[model samples]
Target: MASTSVSKKRKREAGDDAKASFVLSTQPKSQLGPVLANFPSVKPSKSTTFSCYQTGGNAKALGDADDAEFAELPTLIAGETDSVDFHSANQPTGCRYLVGVHDKKTGITTIRPAPVHTLARDVKALKSLEPIAVSVLQRLEARAALGETFGTKKAKLAIKAQERNKVDVSAMETVVDHLQESIQKSTQALPSKEEAQATADSTRLVPPYNAEATVPSEVYPLHNIIPEAEWRTLAATPFLVVGQMQRTPLLPFQRSQWINQHLHSICESSSPSKTNIKILLYISYMMFFRKFAIQSNLGKVVLEEKLASMSPVVADGLLSRFTESARSSSKPQFTSQKETLLLTHMFALCLRVDDYATDTELIARDLSQSTQSINTLFKSMGCQITKLTLTDLKRLGLPDGAAGTKRALLKVPLEFPKPRGKRRRK
Candidate 1:
């Protein structure tokens, strides 16, 4: 009987040792308690747990409800609070950490911080997940599944792009048609007047001539030919022809004949009732005077001779006709014509008078004639010419006091005294 008791004692000690070993292996490190403690705060109070595998293999505890207390255990166990399964309570799902409690009373199975290696393994697997083309396709498929989200907007954008393309096509057609029409019209147009003139001026013509022709009879007649010695003898009297031409006396008459021809043309073309004859005569006389002025040393001698040679009645009649035209017309038909005539008359008078060198009698006379003509012209216009004073001259682009002085100066004859005898040494 004593041996038997000793054997029971030995058995008891072995059981105790087994319990100690289990406790040591299952005990959580203190560092894990804080981390695990945070889990309870996040645990859903109304969450349900269930053992998906077996019904009776789990114990359901109503969280925060008056439920029967369970005995504590030292070993890890699976339990359910409500329907949530604790079979893998210490394991982490993809997103949450699973925690458990260690019961200290019973040596039977109880929930505690069980092995979390499975939870860690699951988290690691998720971390290794990579995106692929298939993932993008799946996302697009999901978006398409939710068609009401974006499909309508994309369809509208496509419609707008098609409308814009149509507008561009229409505009291009219109532009091409316009360009072709313009090209056709421009090609059919005629050349301009200036272009025709340029073309005509660029053309060249050749004269008809033979390169090798004997002294042509028509060019060098036998009657005009003379011996070389006779020609040399005649060359010594070179001035004979020039002297004869100068002494012909009919040279002036010939020149006057040409002037008369032009004058007749002017008379034939002009109207008698319109004063055109007098106008033409004035132009002719002015032209002759200008030529004579340049040739006679600025109207020194030739102008005097020409004026003296003219019949007094004819000269007076011409002058009186010009003055009458100036008086009858409210407006001078040609101002340049009138000015030319007056200037020529003044030049002629200047050449006629030798006393003009000292005194301005001739100039004064011409000035009086001009003033009277102007006054009559203004009177025809029903305006007083004398009323156009220095003030009016300013309006005509002349300076103040210019009217009187310029008028006075223009009336003076342009003449210089002929030099007397040669100067003697002082």
Candidate 2:
């Protein structure tokens, strides 16, 4: 009966997708209609009923539902964010839309869409109903709550695939167009067949053109050029061209891989002063020598060579100093046992005690000094050791001097030790 009534109505007004009485209009200031004012505080339900619908990406007012008038609404590309599904019997016949809210803390997405018309009419309090708004503010708020993935549809996958396909096809088409253009240009540039044959025939070695007057002598530079013939025949040259650039020796210090990177650039940029380069080379050599001089393995010959590299005068002076002082003598030291004991005592006494008269008889006791040589011992004593000792002072005697405290210093000896032969300076 209902189908017959709808058929009669449609025929009366020229059949339309929706009959006039049932035609939905969202032309008011808000697509949500009077629902906003009616339900100022429409709390969402535990079972989410809304989802966001992305209309053709432009900022078109959804109130212009006429644009999609013939098509069904909410062409849901990807939705299923939750497990709850509505029964088929409860689904709406007209266009449907989505509304959603997001909960950021829980990462939950909730959406509600246009409810069944039967449900809308059955409910007394409209506060239970939530109408879908054209403004995206509701969708934005929902996203903030649930995050984008929880309740949102992935409708963009199909759209992205389409865009990718379009790009590929456009690129292929452009390549084909360019190839066609090049092919056409080449074809137009080609000479006609009759002219091509005549030109080829003219280049051939026929009579009156070369030796048979066929090939022209003037066409080749090698045949008649005197300068080229002279150059080919000449064996010895009189003049020479020398390059102005003289290579600067890159010193070993600057040969490090790290330094090489910048060394050439720095050298090229430097002012043309050979003196400065020489000075820098000498300085690096000296620095290297100074660092290596104390090494035990260094030989005198090598040292001399290094010193001579700097200057002959420097080498001479260095050798003189080496032989006189720094050089170690190979002669074995011969010290009598008593001489050794006496020298040891002298070293210790000098460290702990200050001034005292040198005793010649005591020093000459059993060592090889035919006569007392107290002066030699005194001369070898060096500076008095500043390190003070109680026994040393008592033995030498005194807060006043060592004249009366002999028993106080039995541990220390009074006699000065004999010194060995002096190392004479050259």
Number of the top TM-score candidate: 2
List model 1 lDDT by residue over 1-426, tens digit each: 455433434345434554521333243332122122223322434454322121243644323232222111111233344334333334333443334444445554433332222211123344468755568747745755555455588865665565465545565886898999999899778678777654543331111112232422122121122223322322212212333343223122224332343334433443322222232233344445434443443322334468553334434433332332346654323234544444434332222221111123223342334555543322221122232366446544555654444222111121212226788999
Query: lDDT value for candidate 2?
Result: 0.35
The lowest-lDDT stretch of 10 consecutive residues in candidate 1 is: 350-359
What 10-residue stretch in candidate 2 is worst by lDDT? 235-244
Give the per-residue lDDT digits (tens) of candidate 2, residues 165-280: 55455558758978999999999978897787557545432111112222222221221211232223222111111111222233323322222222233345434333223323
Q: What number of clashing residue pairs does each candidate have, in the order they appear?
A: 8, 22
In terms of lDDT, model 1 sits at 0.35
Instruction: Report the Cα lDDT for residue 286, model 1.
Output: 44
Each model's lDDT comes to 0.35, 0.35
Candidate 1's C-alpha runs over 4 A off are: 1-274, 298-302, 308-426
Residue 11, candidate 2: C-alpha displacement in angstroms? 99
